[model samples]
Target chain A: MKLHFSTTHEDHRIALLAALAISIYIIESAFPSPLPGIKPGLANVITLFTFLCYGWKIALQVSLLRVIISSLLLGTFLSPTFLLSLSGSLLSLGILMLVHSLFYPHYLRQYQPSAIGYAILASVSHISGQFIVAWYFFIPHPELFKLLPILMTFAVILGIVSGIITQHLINKLCSTHNK
Target chain B: MFTIGNILFKTTDFLILLSVSSLIIWLYSIFWSTDTLYGQAETLQVQYYNQVAIDYPLDTDRIIKVEGSLGSSIIEIKQGKARFIHSSCRNQFCVFHGWLNIVGDSTACLPNRVSIRLKGTLNPYDAIAGSQ
Candidate 1:
């Protein structure tokens, strides 16, 4: 498939989304986390918005580009942090796509998952992927698995928050475009 | 009305949220319930090369020297708490682990083949969950 941003409009939209996501990622990193691996993951808001507005292909592109470009800007490219981010993004995207397909079959494109469902699934999958990677490759300790409950709790809370924000943004955009 | 992908936030979405929240609560309770016995360790078991070396009551305040694969380790037990004060291992992970006052807490010095585990009936998990 032709994955390139085919038109100037498409390019502009992708660039805007990527910029928003990257900035959110960088800013979130500046905040102090109560725990080492706990963060709100606010950048996912833009990705979810793009997926709801556009489609999975563009959403995937935007999400991957955001992770790569943000990692490079933060000087974490090729580091363990970068690997974790990449793995989380990939896993979340895969789960989102699967859920999307399941909720909206090929013939029924109108019925898609609600924002809350998408966000919860994405967040849970993303954290699970990172936790597995950190436990097996980085720490290799049993104590790390003990942190799962706390992390999952945070994921659920942050997912709902970001999902609500994305839903609002999508609604505003749609209303404006309809006028 | 806020919506995304033509799907509105409806009663169905509320139901999903409620179910997910309950599931998370259940998991949290199972994993981190404070009702489980903690800080009630009755016995301290030391192992060398996967074999039991010594078992002692945790009520006393004393230091024990254990011989392992590499060299000797000094384990200190005080005020119902046990810890490795000194070990010949290079990493010193056991020493840095601070204390093992809980029923299921444990520490190991892989290089010296020495491990200490607290044993009690109310320990929640049989073994720490992790990839083999």
Candidate 2:
């Protein structure tokens, strides 16, 4: 099957992808909240769609470039906070990509459930990465593990919400007529 | 190969339940304990070393004192708030942390072996329990 991008032209498609990623990052970051880290991670939806539509290489590129640009644009460049955010994004993307490749085709009919499952897992991975880095550098303590369960509860709730949203958008965008 | 994602998803529901329960447990533990268990005031030690040396039995509400010899610094606190306001350490990160109020709030100058910390808890266990 010829991907839609072949007809859309290379430059236009690239621009579209970049715009989508930047928009996702900006929208997620702008919200002021008491919640420690509750980004919808809308950019992952773009990453997943691109992975399914184009290829893993492009998806990886999109995730990496988006994170780097977002960090620089957000004025967190080269800081530990930027590194923590990058690590979470990369870990989440890696988990999503792996899940998509192996179980996605087999569980196509259960896309919503699959999305939820993947979202929860990705959230855990992201949180774990951040916690590890934070514990090692910022707040060092073995007792810090006590904080994990509280964090996990929030991650599950937010993961389900983000996953449902992502799936809804993906289905709408990936429909035969929409593309 | 089963990735961490697979293991996590398989247990996501269970883990969420467990986390909720544990959070309740932690909260209960915090509120119900009769003794006030403080986090070690090591961090507060650094801030103490930056100011002038002080003697014991403090009586002021807000006092800041820093004291240290050539290689030893000690910040003594006798009141409500204290901090590692400054330090001669190489990094000087402790000096930047400023004031802290929590019991055992401290910063240390490792080179000087000096530590500063906020001393007492305003709401001690007896007061918290309304026994006093």
**Number of the top-ranking candidate, with TM-score as the measure:** 1
Tens digits of per-residue lDDT, candidate 1, B30-108, equal: 6665433242578888988967467889889999999988899999999878999999989898999899887878888
For candidate 1, the per-residue lDDT at B46 reads: 90
The TM-scores of all predictions, comma-separated, are 0.63, 0.52
Q: Which stretches of candidate 1 lie over 4 Å from their true place?
A: A1-7, A106-111, A175-179, B1-8, B33-132
- Whole-model lDDT, model 2: 0.58
- After superposition on all C-alphas, the RMSD of every candidate to the true structure, in Å, is 12.4, 15.0
The residue pairs found clashing in candidate 1 are none
Instruction: List lDDT for all candidates, in order.
Output: 0.81, 0.58
State how far residue B95 of model 1 sits from its true place (Å): 36
Q: In model 2, where do residues sit more than 4 Å from their true spots? A: A1-14, A52-55, A101-113, A175-179, B1-132
Each model's iRMS: 3.3, 8.2
**CAPRI quality of model 1:** incorrect
For model 2, what TM-score does chain A reach? 0.76
lDDT by residue for model 1 (A1-179), tens: 76764577887889989999999999999899988888999899888878767888889999999999999999999899999999899898898888677766565454455677688878888998898888888999755656887888899888888888777787778443211
Candidate 1 displacement at residue A109 in angstroms: 6.5
